[model samples]
Target: MIWTIKKAIYRAMHGSLKVMMVLFNLPEPELFTGAGSSLKIPEVVKSKGINNVLVVTDKVLMELNLLEGLFNSLKENNVEYKVFDDVSENPTIQNVEDGLKLYLEGKCAGIIAFGGGSPMDCAKAIGARAVNPKRSVLVMKGLFKVRRKIPPLFTIPTTAGTGSETTIAAVIKDPDTHEKFAIVDMKLIPIVAALDPELMVGLPPHITSSTGMDALTHAVEAYIGVCGNKLTNENAEKATKLIFENLEEVYKDGLNLEKRNNMALASYYAGVAFTRAGVGYVHAIAHNMGGLYGVPHGLANAVILPYILEFSRKDAEEKLAGLAIAGGIGTPIESNEELSYRFIEKVKAMNKNMGIPSSIKEIQIKDIPLIAERAVKEGNPDYPVPKIMNQKECEGIIRKLLP
Candidate 1:
């Protein structure tokens, strides 16, 4: 009875949120896509009258010399830039602070987030700190707490996952507590995004597989969630179709720029869907896994996705069936139940094909309680999930991930 009341309250809150979101008039990032599109961002920055900019990335990308082209392009555009490549896989508050220090000291007029979600998230938080110097990122947690506009922000997504390039979210971990929390505000959306497949041509197979699944999770969650509007539904469906068709193909042949570009667009579409409609337990559980076990976000999402779908399958059956149809994996002749089951099975098969583990080896049994607690806290009253879960239920589902 108490759980029933809680769900009612959550639904009511979500209803109000839908109204608020419409009032917010959320903006999508102006996108530049295709081969060598990343090179165009520097020119856009210069056109915006930004003379100096900060580039946020990670050491792995820098080591591979992926940024060399971007750097040279910036120079050719006569745009001075500073580099902060200390962003970890799961970005910490310290990463933001360190990057903010560079942005301030260099007097950067804007920020260019280069790489996957981590650098983009760190850059967003740094920009948040830049504009609202008095507000700690801790205080900026939850929805719409950012007081002012962030600095002019641009994103170049090297991986077609996380959709951080178009998202209004930045997930940051507290190193002290190991708790990962997202700071969500419409102000966090980037001013521009470049979906350049040229940059993703060298992505390792593991990254290609996991991040592609991350985009799938985003599309699935957004489509099934109750908060979806027509726009979110359409974007999610298109993203689902593109990911289903192109992710594995690109995974096997990373040099296929067309497939890579399709995956990139799919990621952006999924990002747009979830940014508006919201994600569910897949994200909630995945965030905790990343926070506690130092697991890669995409890998965590990929592994946990099948389990969450099974749990929510009954409730999300119609939605799943629709997605299965959209993804070209089902026909109208199939019943909703059959199509839903097929969708979940397809996800499992994809994980197997890509060598993604069904269970997380890193999830310690001792930490299950804390993991479940945080996941429920992050999910409830916020994510408009198809079905609500209690702590005990969440714990049970997470336990299955133990290897």
Candidate 2:
């Protein structure tokens, strides 16, 4: 009964948000893609008339020297910047607070998000807070809450996943609840995004596979969701094809810049597709897994994706079948149902080939109800999931993901 009421409230909220989105008609960011596009970040910063900048990133990226190219560009351009490398795998509100503090203390004029989803998300949250200092990050949790324009924000993604570079949403977890929440507003969108495959070449095989699957989930969910339109479908189709073709090659030979570039483009395309159309139950549950069990976001999404596809098959058959053909898993002559199953099998095979485990070993049975409740709360109405799952149904799905 509580879940029913929560769903009704979320549905109502989403209905109003759809109306608001149409009313506002937000614009997407300028994107630069290729092997050396990240070198353009300093130029973009100068063009925006920004002097001092806040660089939000993680220690791993720094240790790997993945940020050297961007740092060199900034130095060559004589741009002053402060680095805050404390962002966690699942960024917390505290991370945002700490970054924002640094941004203010340094009197930064702009933000350069310099890593994966966590840093990008933390940077956006910091940008939002810089503009709206009166409101808490907690108050800015839902759609269209950010009314003011944030400072100029630029992104240089070291991973070919999350698509946070192009998306207008940011996910941050609360320290008290250990639950993840999102800030969805056009103001959170970066002014510029650099999808430079050169930065991604050093990713380990496991990271490559997991992040590739994450991109796949974004594309597949966007294609299957009810909010998808013709433009989004086109992007999703292309993203699916690129990921299917390039992910394995890049996973096998991490230094292959050509395959790496293709995977980066696939991630960008998936990001664009899902930013407008939105993702589905896979992300909805995966976010909870990350928050609750410390599961890596990409790995969680990769493991949860096939099961959700199976659950959504009845409603998303034609779309999934189309994706199967786009992904080269099925011929045009195959029936939609057969094609859909073939697509599911292909995903499973890809996971096996990439060394992504089928189940999450850390998921506790006792936590399913809470995870299910949070998943439903996060996905209902807004996500346009083929089937709306109640707590019990969501628990059933999570049970299958357990070791």
Q: How does each model score on TM-score?
A: 0.99, 0.95
lDDT tens digits, residue span 161-221, model 2: 8989888899999878878889998888888998888888889999999988999999999
Score each candidate by Cα lDDT: 0.94, 0.88
Query: What is the Cα-based TM-score of model 1?
Result: 0.99
What clash count does candidate 1 reach? 0
Q: Which sections of candidate 1 miss by over 4 Å?
A: none
Give the TM-score comparing model 2 with the true structure, all chains together: 0.95
**By TM-score, who's the top model here?**
1
